[model samples]
Target: MSAPLGVIVAVRGEAEAAVVAEVDAHPRLTVVRRCADLAEAVAVARAGLGAVVVLSAQPHLDADAVAAIRAAGAGIVGVGGGPGSRLEALGIAVARSALAEAVLAAVSGPAPEFVAPPERGTAAMVAVWGSGGAPGRTTVAVNLAAEAALAGHRTILVDLDTYGASVATALGLADEAPGIAAAARAAARGEDAGALLDRHALEVAPRLRVLTGLTRAARWPEVTAPGLERLWPALRAAADVVVLDLAAPADAGASPQGPGPRRDGATLAGLAEADVVIAVGGAEPHQLVRLVHVLLDHDGPTPVVAVNRIRAAVAGPRPEDAIAAALGRHAGVTEVWPLPWDLRACDAAARDGRTLAEAAPRSPLRRAIASMAEVVVAAARAARDAPATVTD
Candidate 1:
């Protein structure tokens, strides 16, 4: 038989005894290490020394600790029991019974299945985002997924914008299927997410699975960061390529300027988890500046920039050249794609609730989108092939 999986438990104060007793009772998990704080626990996990981590509910544990655990590529389970208390949303099973054997059985069970690993050399994320105005993010995402599918890649397009999601509307399937929100809710309740793919997804193109956004803004609370974390790994395993259409946040304030309580929080969480970010901006100077500021606050990977509504005869330099130059100086943006001002094509596509490829395949806009997809696919492949490394 295979050796028992090793697990690390993090506890503080009087909780240490409870966790130690649980670890001792588990037959399938050998407690390799115990830490008094999240940082110490993270250090042990990052060393590739443990298959799982159990973190006690402590006031000191925060989201950063959780991110570190995920970046280290280990499972984390949070424990909690008190008035007005809830377990932190780790993807692993939660143990409230304070029983060591029961908890160990849950944690040591078979790992959840995901979509097959991405193509051997493919990166895993392609994000489509836009500036303040409607820059056709959903349109770009839908057509891009279709293009990827046509190219023979098993593709999935996810709508992650909680407050103003429109993938269903763009596909003309509004309120027709229980899309991303349902999947997220299922994950939040610790249910199997693979079932979500079979039950909730609506097939928009051949071999392309569509994880649509919320049916309404009021449903934003159902989609949390932990729920998304659980869903995305399964999605990546199931599809050859994954495209995410994100809501454009105006700024990194307390919340996004949308019509809901948790809109901004959800958007920020989505950004943090995304592998690639596509920042879509308009031709205007102020709009480009806003995109730059948003990118700075995010302070992660630099995103591919796309300038929308380019009119050569109207005002300034070519939108692509101008935005590239400005972003290079301000946001260090080197990659930029441009979409020409094609109001007729955009309006017609929106009217029919179809993608630009279906409504206006010959439009100059299609070329830009196609080019963006090619670059995105290449980048994703490179990231996937990169070697894994330990982090502090």
Candidate 2:
């Protein structure tokens, strides 16, 4: 005869005894472990000691924990929770009244199928990417999003920087907000991402919404590439223009959690999903070289390169010309946008927790960003008007 399926029961209270008795009596279901709590259940699941986990409704049983358990290759069946409970969102749930029948069916049942939402008028996603030396990536992303919003496009600025997420601080929003992490978790759970964003996204300005990044750098694993893959389509459906403030694209292969999600997963994911990539770089010679390398290595969409803090001290006598010649010679990039260095204006905006347009509307840097925003708006309009290609 075939071996019985391994089951881990984590139900609490008096109901636990009845559930265990029922499972033990089943011929096809074998109780491998009776976990004291969700943590133990998760650990046991991670160890691959159980094929199915029968759990109770616990306050800590969130989507992250559910994802971790599923990632460990275990099926979940909740006992005692009624319809519309948290368990329903996590996975399969059965009533305690039908313990034996429900447990058996849950363990032996075929996997449920997930239907993707029908394609609609998806938004244009723009990724603001830069190299390692802090080339004003966040600054550009924030300002560009603000400009887009000012121009009447519904814009969402997502901070996907796993290394250092400072969009919240820059925009004067609370840093501890759930932001993109919560959205990713919802996406992982197959929840309606647009509805979730409506609840979690912070509206700092008219027509502009902000989804902040990680609360802790160590929590990078929560934002996996696969999770973001599910998230991108939903994000596209949520806004007219999605601005992603991404981390530097340096490959940090497999994190400490083995060959799972890496540190740079967010950056890579954003780049892949972006309709246009705004590659930002400092105007200094060395920074310019790094930008050239970035341009050369990128094989995706044609990037709109913007050189920030352009000055005679860094780019020599004629800053704009020097930048143009260098980029043209090294990276074959002919056209370039130069954002003049206006430290006073930038400092005032940063101090006041406002975008360039709001704090220093007349700043030369603000004008440059506004012009870039116009270009982005035009690109989005063209893309939306283009014919949608069908795939097999």
Judged by TM-score, which candidate is best?
2
Model 2 spans with C-alpha error above 4 angstroms: 91-121, 172-200, 212-239, 250-274, 292-303, 316-336, 378-392
Please, what are the lDDT tens digits per residue for candidate 2 over residues 1-392?
99988889999899899888888898888899998998999999899998888888876675566667777878777788777555665555556475656656655676432334455447888889977699999999999999999999999999999999989988888878999998887666656666778888999999999999998988987787756766676677778999999997674343454534678878988888787888999998789988988898887877889999999998789999999998999899978989899999889889999999889999999999999988976786676567979999
Whole-model lDDT, model 1: 0.70
Clashes of 2: 0
Worst 10 residues of 2 by lDDT: 111-120
Clashes by residue pair, model 2: none
lDDT per model vs. reference = 0.70, 0.82
Q: What is the lDDT of residue 273 in candidate 2?
A: 75
Which candidate has the top score in lDDT?
2
lDDT of 1 by residue, 168-250 (tens): 88778866577888887766544556667778887887888898888887877777665676676677777888888888774
* Candidate 2, RMSD to the unseen true structure: 4.3
TM-score of every model versus the real structure: 0.68, 0.77
